[model samples]
Target chain A: MPYVNIKVTKENGGLTKEEKLTLIKGVTNLLAETLNKNPASTVVVIDEIDMDNYGLGAEQISDRRKAGK
Target chain B: MPYVNIKVTKENGGLTKEEKLTLIKGVTNLLAETLNKNPASTVVVIDEIDMDNYGLGAEQISDRRKAGK
Candidate 1:
């Protein structure tokens, strides 16, 4: 089983259930179609992270958004 | 920057804040130490998932636990 984890900023009150389901299905399908992994066994977990808790290029995504750069 | 995502069953009421912090720190340190990645730029997101949503070996973890195998 291939465990896939997706991380996204908890913006806009986080993702809706439909978005989460779509993601789960899409990732499962892609892995199954490309990697030959069994879709029934593939697991996908989505994480809604606080912008402050996530950093990229040594700066938090929130800060980047604030700076508008 | 390396982004590490961790997924665990939402058992035992999920992990405590301290546990999540420890996991984030530990994974960040490991990646920095071994991969030469900047700890300041590394991101770690831990997802506590429902057992029913996670599958392994073509079976849900919850089912496995119930079967006591």
Candidate 2:
């Protein structure tokens, strides 16, 4: 039941909303101190993508097209 | 850049080595399909945790204690 999902590239800003909830509570306290467990069952999910909606295969994309896609 | 990380109880046992790979690919594909992005750019990470090694608060531990924790 350990979950961590991070999808970045929404301009890759430093982060705001309280530093994205303090980076999901500092990555759930670093996975409960690297596997000691029980930081409220550890569940973190962060997804933010922009770069013209994201890409990579048809051409190196993402990174929000350098702010001009 | 979009990434997905799913961590489940290792004892869940609904997947094998190849199935794990398939799960990753499937998740990636789902993300690409849902977001209409390049499959290569979407990274998916799945971490498995054992119940004995993972806990929920101070009790009600993970789904791993049924074996005699």
Candidate 3:
């Protein structure tokens, strides 16, 4: 089984269910095409994190965005 | 930076925020102890999926659970 996890910053109110579905389909198809993995056994999970909870370069993502860096 | 994703069935109404936090901290510490990764930049996310969406042996988890197998 091929398990894929996607972590995305929760920006702009995060993604809609339709968008998440699109991502799931696209990633599954990509693994099938590239790795010959069976889509039937492929698992894709998406995680949306609040910017405040995400850190980069020892600073929170919210601070980074605020600094425009 | 190391990113970790945990997938669990949405059983018993899923995990509480405190449980998730414990998992995140435990995983971060594990990575640091075993892999020399920095907990500061580590990211951990948890995804809870409906049993109906998860399949095994070409059978949906919901169905398998219903069969008591």
What DockQ, between 0 and 1, does each candidate earn? 0.17, 0.30, 0.11
Candidate 3, B1-69: lDDT as tens digits: 899988787877889999999999999999999999999999998978766544444444556578997
Winner by lDDT: 1
TM-score (chain B only), all candidates? 0.89, 0.66, 0.86
**Candidate 1 clashes between residue pairs 3 or more apart in a chain or in different chains:** none
Q: Which ranges of candidate 1 are over 4 A from the true structure?
A: A1-6, A11-47, A50-69
Better of 1 and 3 by lDDT: 1
Indicate which candidate wins on DockQ.
2
* Reference-based lDDT, residue A66, model 2: 51
TM-score list, all predictions: 0.55, 0.50, 0.55
- Model 2 chain B worst lDDT run, 10 consecutive residues: B60-69
TM-score of 3: 0.55
Q: How close to the true structure is residue A54 of candidate 3, measured as C-alpha lDDT?
A: 90
Better of 1 and 2 by DockQ: 2
Alpha-carbon RMSD of each model: 7.8, 8.8, 7.8
Misplaced by over 4 Å in model 2 are: A2-4, A11-44, A49-69, B12-14, B60-69
- Candidate structures ordered by DockQ, highest first: 2, 1, 3
